[model samples]
Target: MAEMFSMLGTWNWLVLGLLLMGLELLAPGVFLFWLGLAALLVGLLSFALSLSWQLQILMFALFAVAAVPLWRRVARRNSGASQSNPFLNKRSDALVGRVFTLEKPIVDGAGTVRIDDTIWRVAGPDAPAGSRVRIVRADGASLTVAAD
Candidate 1:
């Protein structure tokens, strides 16, 4: 293992960097990009001044660690520029804060509300059919509602 480290040259570092970056295309978790950049920086540093294989690896590790904070800061600053839809996959959440008539009578704190063509299970006070109810929140597949 020590000999392998000693034999790693500047070209080896560059190749390793390219290979790590290529892996990013395969498994895109946004992590390998930082490691790839680290290897590339080490290669450049080695080109300027001859460095031992161990030193090159140390520089790569340092650079990779340093890049994480920079990436997080960039993501934090840009997060508000275009807000992502938090309710994209949550269908029940979209029903909250809307008033809908009870399709079925609410007996024993259970009922159903018809929103358009879809019938959704709801939990609230007992009420007769056609009574107006306001959706307060959603719990999994059920909506929590109250009298509007």
Candidate 2:
């Protein structure tokens, strides 16, 4: 078994890298891509030079150290400048700045407002039912409203 494992050479590493890359398609995140690149580099280096086990370990460690920070920097540059849609994954965020009519009177700073057939708990200065209110902000399932 040990001999069979030892027989795996540079080509095996290359194949492993391809497998990792293929897995990345199934689970698309930033992680496996770097590891696969490292493996591919190691395979090419092993093919070019007869590397000792210590050199192989050192190469893998160096690849990890270098690739992680570089990948993070690239990822941040790609993602940081863009504004994320507030409505993305949060449907209530779309209600901000929209106007609604109070369905129930706000007594002691709490009331309900009907928005698209759903009554949402609201907090604002005291207001009567049927008053026009604008959504100032959303807190969980509740809307912080103000007189429109």
Off by over 4 Å in 1: 1-3, 18-32, 44-55, 78-94, 115-118, 128-131
What lDDT score is found at residue 3 in candidate 1? 95
Q: How would you encode candidate 1's per-residue C-alpha lDDT over 41-122 as one tens digit per residue? A: 9998999999988888889889999999988998898876645666667878877899999999899999999998899899
- Cα lDDT computed for each candidate against the true fold: 0.91, 0.85
**Per-candidate TM-score against the hidden true structure:** 0.60, 0.56
Which candidate tops TM-score?
A: 1
Q: Could you tell me the TM-score of candidate 2?
A: 0.56
The residue pairs in collision within model 1 are none
Error of 1 at 106 (Å): 2.7
